[model samples]
Target: MILWFTYILVAIAALGGLLCVVLGLAGRRPSDLTVGILGLLELGLIAQVVISIIAPFAGNPPTGSLLEFWVYLVTAVLIPPAAVVWALLERSRWSTVIMGIAALAVAVMVWRMQVIWTVQGS
Candidate 1:
């Protein structure tokens, strides 16, 4: 895995978390800008997933279990939309808080994925 791409995604996800948390602390519901940030993060995660899936086929497989890598990748990709849907359903500042947590979770998952990619027997 390219370290720069991982760094970029991690930075964006961390920023997203901070943004949503701030919005929530301000007692505001999830706004379009917040959703847009999540949307962009989701797109990046999806692209990462695509690259991860293809890398193995291109003879650059992970040293770890490919299935585990994919599971983590998929989970990371799905988190933003699920958070958005739940945020819409709740219609409260807590929903924004949920997005913050989701973003943080995705960031952690991505980090674990990087470990899984580079560390043998992970």
Candidate 2:
């Protein structure tokens, strides 16, 4: 696991969480900008997955159990899309709340991935 990448993901998720909180507080509905940001975040996650997939084959075996890594990877990849679809269907502040929760989940998963990597390394 790349510590830098994990940090970056955490930062992104934190920012998204802040935005969602602000939107919720201001009584604003989910907007296109929010969706766009979520899309970008999703792309970033996809990139992370791609890099992770290639790293092990490129002589950098992941310092984590393959099964756990796959679970985290798949969930991270699914989150943004799931949030977006749910937001579109809901179209309320609840959508933003859901996005916020999703972002928080991403952060937690990143942390877990890091821990898994560390444990495997030991």
Candidate 3:
């Protein structure tokens, strides 16, 4: 994984999570801003997926367990859509909070994938 891109993704996810949580705590329901941020995050994840696929063949294969990295990537990619669906269906402050939590979770998972790629070598 590219270090800078990973950092950017982490920052975006963290900030997005914080924003949604604060909004929810202030008694606001999910808004387009929140959903849009998550949509951006999902797009980034998809890009990462493509990069991961290409990186291996371009002489930058992960040093850690490929299985573990792929599992994390797949799961991280799923979280945003799930959270957005819940928020849309519930239309409540708690749903916003849940979306925030999901974003935070994705951030951590992405970081872990980075570790697996760059630090944990066989």
* lDDT tens per residue, model 2, 3-112: 79888888888788678868866777788877876787788788888888787777767666878887987898898889989989999988887887788788788778
Supply candidate 3's per-residue lDDT for 80: 99
How many residue pairs clash per model? 0, 0, 0
Q: Rank the candidates by lDDT, best first.
A: 3, 1, 2
Clashing residue pairs in candidate 1 (N, C-alpha, C atoms within 3 angstroms): none
How many collisions between residues are there in candidate 2? Answer: 0
- CA lDDT scores, all candidates in order: 0.88, 0.81, 0.95
Best-matching candidate per TM-score: 3
- State which candidate, 1 or 2, has the greater lDDT: 1
Instruction: Give the Cα error of residue 39 in candidate 2, in Å.
Output: 1.0
The digit string of per-residue lDDT tens for model 1 on 1-122 reads 65789999999999999999899989989999888889989999988977886787888778887788889988898899999999988989999989998998999999889888988674
Task: Estimate candidate 2's alpha-carbon lDDT, on a 0 to 1 scale.
Answer: 0.81
lDDT of predicted model 3: 0.95
Best by lDDT: 3
Worst 10 residues of 2 by lDDT: 113-122
Task: Name the regions of candidate 1 deviating beyond 4 angstroms.
Answer: none
Candidate 2, which segments miss by more than 4 Å at Cα? none
Pairs in steric clash, model 3: none
